[model samples]
Target: MTQTTEFDWRPFLLRWSGEWSDWSDSRSDDETRSEGDEAARQGRWLGFPPASEERIVAMEKRLGRQMPPSYRQFLKVSDGWQHAGGFVWLLAGTTDARWHDNESGLADMFEEDLDEDAGPDERRDAEIWRRGLQLEVESDATYVLMDPEDVDDDGEWAVYTWAGWRAAPPERYANFAEFMRDMHREFHSLRAHRTEGEPEFANDTTRELDALVEKARLMALRGEWERAGRTLDEAKEYGRPRAVGLGDQIRRLLGQTYMVYFEDVVTDPRYAPELLPSLVAEHAAHSYRDDSTLMFHLRGAGDDVVSSAYATLERVRDGTYRYTAAGPFGEAVERARELARWGDTDGAWRTLMDALPLWQPLGPDHLAPMGWVADPLLGPLLTPDRGRELLSTPRGGQAGEAPARSAGLDADNLTWLADPDAHDNLTSYRFVLVEGVAPEDLPGRLADGDEAALDDPMTSDEARRRSLGGQREFSSYDDRALMSVGRAGDRWSFAFDGDPAHFDPRRFVSPAAAAAAAATAAGAGARAVVVWSGLRTWRGNPFFHLSVARDGAERYAFTYADAEIHRTGEIPRALDPDRFFGSGSGKVEGEGHAEAERSLLEAVTGEFGVHLPRHAITNGRLHTFTSRSWTRAPGNGETYAVISLNLVRE
Candidate 1:
């Protein structure tokens, strides 16, 4: 069909015969479907017997023309074929192949709808459909039509595939063989998502090609990217169905190209940290909203990786952060920048590409040399080649240390913690600070019993799981409530623990109340201050509550849950509520409730001398404990929402 005399159909048809199934249910009997099994046992192809030369001659006499060379050769190999991939059930033998009957009326419909403004391709497609030979004996709303008028120099007719339901025009191919190859590829693509029980090709050449594609895949995963690229290029030459996509993948990793389809992007875990953020940014430029495909995969690299990327994006957009290159890579980037500034963008791009191999991350969040995206001089000059090169090159390196931070509290340092949408978890924060206590002692003091221990301190993630009762709906009424404790100076801070998504809503209500009750019970005359500040609740409302416990007794409490306010004791003269939530307050224009929450936190911390260091609370290995007495019991008449439940009568 491709006008190539060297082409052979026997090998491909043999492979198809081995793997073919009547996926369309065109064959009604079990005996017909069992032919392949019997043939496999006998070590022979299952294709039907080839058409004799006399049959071909008679069909040509009836049609008044000779069949296309490739199609004619194909008939000599197999009279007919089953499961030519997609919706096609079988190609017709010489006995049934004839001029189209136009029973579907698609040709007449398209002809009547044709407009004078239609393009050349559209007009040609309509003409092909209106007067073509039908080759399919059976199919599901699929047409295999060949046009004699659209013949090649070697008298090979152009083939067209059309589905009645699809909105697009008919897909044209060079000839019958090209169309069959595409359908074979479609078969592979359709089953690509399934990772189990891969099909074995019967033919040696097909088997070899499939093996090459898989080998390239494994090589890419092992960071043998150059080798994988070469393998994929070779597999492509062999006409492997998956080779083109796999080659694109290797190209993406090598920074020679980029993929619009994010799911197809497979990152080497070693380079994911360096590549994912830039990958996300590249996708973001083309997309209107965030892409979950790359974002979810990017998050697998590390905990702070996604957040750090977001911070970088925000800073870049706001013009506050600029990437300053370091080392040989940085010097090359500088040269590129200088060249770009001089209006020699091509030179700048070439300079950047040349330095890609020398690229190393300056810091953990130094995603890439992304200056080009933001640089006015270089932004306009970026082509797919240059952009993908920046995205995927400098592919391998361990991240450097983060920059040092100042000791005292900086407003900017609190921004990420304050923003509700910034991180996936810990959006709702509640902390209790008790004076005159050690970090380890806070856990014991805040628990009903001595269940809280420091001998086996768990990581924050482990503590979160234990606090939620280890994937169960309920723990015993006396089960401990997990909390993290750390010291900031003379005061110890006890935080309500567990990631926000995992925390049971029934257990989260008024956390300050339970925490205060526990703290003051063991206070021994010490003062404890509790505050729960949420920029936005699960219901999308801002909430705040503050309470104080002194000398083993609760003294004061105040809450601002959306529009309502509740107070338990006389407000402290120092904490003037009017100052924070006066007229034209609560929700400010442009800046929502984050500003209010931040200001209130600052005021409360300053007034009560409550301090929780940003680093210690967020990153340090603080002591973890669970309160044995903090438990909840719903009334018999009360309704509850739960993922799972178990009742114990012990």
Candidate 2:
């Protein structure tokens, strides 16, 4: 039941999507009928039937977001599929695939321990739903939640699953595709084992759960709470309808996610006992890595519960995060006074919402101070009589999806177009040809004569690579690409990457900035100018395909938390397309980006006769550079002349 990094989900999605279908039109009547009969015999899964587009659209509207590509396509093949009586359980269909509501939530497993006086209001369920959309799988006992809120740049949400048992924290998969792909294999293996009498994970379901718990324990010891939490959830299902000693041990291990390890979170030697009584006081508000900062802030609160709550609230607004993975929430609001203070304030409204469950154990004496705030995850924390009022809110639309682009260009030449969370690597050819418009007939460029007109900052090639690398996982600036083009003298320079804290990008002052810069670099009479950039993930994964990794330092999808701004009117109307290719505006990546580039080339070559070529390595020359090195290898002596040429960054 532990989430694994070993599966390559892309291939599986393709195979499943194309595997079984309405018999091909080209097949003979007898062959088609036989295939159809066989599929019908297999029933739900083997006879996969794609759901209607209208149905998918309606489902997306109901959920208020898009489903992961593989999941959506899987539905196209089989709107719903199920397997019973073994490790495989219930897999919900389009009709039943809805986000969990306030009433029928898995968190209710904690009901026995919750006090009526201070327990979280119905809205807590709604809040959790905002962060993740739940889909039932496997006997209604286990469920997977799609976390679109914390996605990589490529719009792939990390998938987490939990068994509906008291205190079962969810474990995670890299994406919905991975979950589907791996789950398929697991079911096949489990079924095989059951039929073969192997018996490890088949007939004895409890033993299977036991092995899962062991795996989780090992993961927890190694600091992988997502999988650890996940495996334990599966174990909880094994002991369902009755509590087990094993589940208790699982909770203790999962608790490590929020607890500081053998050290004070506030990091101050002076306040020996931290201001927050428990290590979890600030766990939800900030990363555990910031021990010094947490200690400094926690020290300011002294021992007062109200002070600690307020401080945590402030920090949450200031932007703190739980590192690597999220932790189990709604378990600790035992403090009444602190909850009361947060319930009334604007400063820590979000913190209050996240921590409300902790305070549910308090009496009505603490009720007077509780209230509402404008939050995406806003819940019914206070009773109706307490009142819902406007309060401080984070900037809305932070996670909005990009609108569909209306530019009707046919996708033919291009292979893929990813809405890159940010800039491009100059390692491979990925020249961004903006729009299909001609610069000659338009207004002045986005930038003009002075450096002031081109306000975008320039940096080292290393900076470009670093920015792109970090974005392959989760990053703040994973939206738009600010394509910067410049020239010092005879050589043209360009580096397209994400926005970095240390770098700034120049805006266009005239329609001719980029074109004119290229023309100027090649000298006035030059017929064409070469512009180029490379493609790479932040971790330097090869361009054009998704790479699943255990962490950000390796290849993963280009997942970003926000939408791109490039599709807006930011680029010059003269040189920019209504929507850049690969903006995720109803277009796939590989083909979208490629076709967009091709169309742009057609327009530029036909209108401006601009010649695009390999990237230039040096400021004085245009070519790819490999760090200025040479190796003496044995060579066939056919060519004799020595040559000199300008190089670009390799």
Best by lDDT: 1
State in Å the error of residue 193, model 1: 3.6
Q: Which residues of candidate 1, in runs, are more than 4 Å off?
A: 1-3, 19-46, 195-207, 210-246, 249-259, 266-268, 273-279, 290-327, 334-347, 353-380, 384-650
Say which candidate scores most in TM-score: 1
Per-model lDDT: 0.57, 0.36
- Model 1, CA-based lDDT: 0.57
Please report how far candidate 2 places residue 213 from its true position, in Å.
24
| Model 1 weakest 10-residue run by lDDT | 401-410
Q: Clashing pairs in model 1?
A: none
Per-candidate TM-score against the hidden true structure? 0.47, 0.24
Q: Write the per-residue lDDT of candidate 2 for residues 1-650, one digit (tens) a residue.
A: 32233345344534332322221232344553454334543441342356898989898898788886656766776776543223334566677676665334545544444456644433333344445676655454565677675566556677766554635445666676667655654543333323233333333444455566665544433334345556655554443211122233223222322333222222332322222222333343355444455544444344554354445455434323111111222222223222222121121233433332223212211111111111111212222221221111111112112222222121222222222421253323322222322222111222223211222122335334543554434322222233333221122222222232211112111112232322232244212222221223243322221111111122111211112222222232333443343445434354444454445445434443333221111111111111100112224653334333444688
Please give, for residues 1-650, the per-residue lDDT of candidate 1 as tens digits.
Answer: 25344567887766655444332232234535355444533544545689999999999999887898878888888887666666887788888888885766776778777898988787776677557889877788898988888888877888998887888788888888887777776664454333345443234555776787676665544345567678777656545555664565445434443542222222333333334444545655555555465465453345465566566556433334334555776687778665443223455566766665566643322334443444333444455444444444434352222222212221222334565544456667666677666556665566645555652333466456555664466433333446666553344444545343222334443434333344433445566777666655553566666777765667787666554566677777665555565543443422556676777776766676555544334432345666543335655776656556665898
